[model samples]
Target: MLDKLPVVGRFLGGRVADDAGWRRMEALLRKCERRPVYRAWIGDVVVCDATLARRALLDSDNCLAREPSVWQFGDKQRVPAATVTELNRWLHGAAARHDVDAAARIAVVALAAASGDLHRAALLAALDSVADMLGFDCNPELAAAVRVYIGDVFHAKLVNAPLDDAQIARAQGLASRVAALLTTCDADLPAVLRNDGVLTGAARGEVYLHAVLSVVGASAVMLAWLACVLHMDTVAGVDTSADSRAQVFTCKPEHVALELLRLWPPASAHGRRVLKDHQVGPVKALRDDDLVIPVFVLHRHRDTWPDACAFAPQRWHEDPRPAAFMPFSAGPGACIGSQFEIRWLAAVVRQAATLGSLQLVQVGRSPCANTMFSPPRCRLETP
Candidate 1:
């Protein structure tokens, strides 16, 4: 019965971690313009082809694609189907009746807290609570991770472990700065993010997580300051001409946000398990085989993007290929937080544009590729 299963169907069952195997798969993707489908194996499962992979991803019915669980990590265990269904129903209902953006923010925060990045999780949660009037649902897993991520950041332990002295001090400093910024911004633009209605229970939880992310972001800014000092000269010529130099310094924070995302994507890659025997152009995949989709590689593919390696904000002024860019993956498994992120980026950029020249002062090494959000570490000094 297993042998008869589609190649793609088998990918659903096991873990796949083969470097060379993926290279071979990429070769197939490269040559697949002419053929509609092909076949391959992820372990014992036979995937039909790349076309099928794309189709499966695009099709909502055959595959079960839903918002990632707030507490789950990795492929080790599947979220109980019933729990996922219940969560989805609640989320959808909340989105329809209440503030969707607030809910989404909470979801991301909850997920981050579960990810073991405590500092970020706690800060985001606190910010959300204060700014959006929302609270986070305190799952045990989330609570434990939050403690680990924000040890010593807050006086009261929201998580199981206590943050050390250094972390606590850092957290306090960040919270103060973020609160000040939010106050200034709120006072300046009351109409943009108005708090009109009472937040639902879930909304409250979401706000808490947002606070955590904001605080974490402040720390990241300090780190970015250090990187800027070291690489100042390297990026100097990139902004040539007096006009461009002026523009660079005056560029809105949104532009900076975009540059940050392109430079350091949050999630390194997205994975999928083939559901049936299918083909993607020329490559063949077996049923249940796992397919590792590298968004970084696709984003920087020279053929797909002109000057793929360079960081040029102006490039966005032109039309970009949809397939080549998957900072938020395409099709069914795409990120639900995309809209919130875009809105936040725009707000940040708009604020920066109005302020004086924002100079980056790098303080530490760039963040390693882990966690869900890929923010740089630096400080901004206006002159």
Candidate 2:
């Protein structure tokens, strides 16, 4: 019923996440293409031009960031330097804590158990790795709840939307639960992350959610998309045989990952609140106004990328990484886990190639209904 009203369906979480949803978003964006920046259908100022998009992202004075909200990015009460340092250390060391091949094997079992539900398989696989890093046993129920709370409740907080009393209660409950779980764990933790008064109270939960959830969410979506693209390319004859697929994964996993990010970024669009009146390109903004940059449109802009819409990983061989490439966003609020996630995805992709040829069990998008634009559902089978 809501599908008829794509806009309404999308906002209310009824829109199907698929090619159709993307086309709808594209059509909305096209209406504003003539202007470098203009008010979108949702009333936020949209930046269409890549140059201006960069300016909007980089101009710390003109806009306030929404994420890394715990420590506040581009706002008063900045994220602590020590916190940042420790966090980076923990993230960088995560790879050394677990075996990538073991995670891939877990993913394969998860996929079969889920009947090809890519998100679940990916989430379960990520849980194993994160558990290893944080020195805890994988708790599927807790992991799934964290994913849900982040996607549903915490997202509202990011946007500064008012939650009802029930929602507020739920948020507090989940945070307390998460804090208790992490703080009381007896496993050996990384030095900086050790529970010796290092992380406690809400701060403890905030850091855990930020780091662990980020990995879980990113790994799930990226691996799912990796599977989707492999299957799609195989069906299209771009990957003529299993050997050819394996060759691409073996030789150029990073390039393929980059291409995937360009074509189907998980965070397809990002928004910021206009702090004060400012001019960016032709657009003038008043204080408290909202500005949105549709990374999806920017990636496929004809003027910015040659052969814009094609899923050609080989382009990375000659094409320099464009400024418009912002799968992890940009500026002060950009995802800190971006580099680690990319390398992790690449590692997992290499292992995936050895599993088997992929087949498209289902094709669906999650962006319309969720903040993360995860790829369609698919299956992996030995050919």
Candidate 1, residues 1-383: lDDT per residue as tens digits? 00121122123211121222233334443543333333333352222233343454565555433334231322333345564454344333332343434433453343233322323332443334223221122233344433433433431232112345877555444433433333223222221112322322323223333334433333232222213322354331133234433433455544544554554344434556667665554455556665544454455455555765555556565554344455555575555444444444444334332322334443323222223322223344433
Pairs clashing within candidate 2: 17-365
Q: lDDT for model 1, on a 0 to 1 scale? A: 0.38
lDDT of 2 by residue, 28-128 (tens): 54654566677655567778788788778877674664444334322134446677666756666765555666665665455434544445555655665
Q: Model 1 compared with the native: what TM-score?
A: 0.49
Which stretches in model 2 have alpha-carbon errors above 4 Å?
Answer: 1-11, 15-21, 60-63, 66-89, 92-116, 138-172, 187-203, 233-251, 354-360, 363-369, 377-383
Error of 2 at 328 (Å): 0.4
Off by over 4 Å in 1: 1-56, 59-77, 80-259, 353-367, 372-383
> Which candidate number maximizes lDDT?
2
lDDT measured at residue 282 in model 2 versus the true structure, 0 to 100: 72
lDDT of each: 0.38, 0.59
- Clash count of each predicted structure: 97, 1
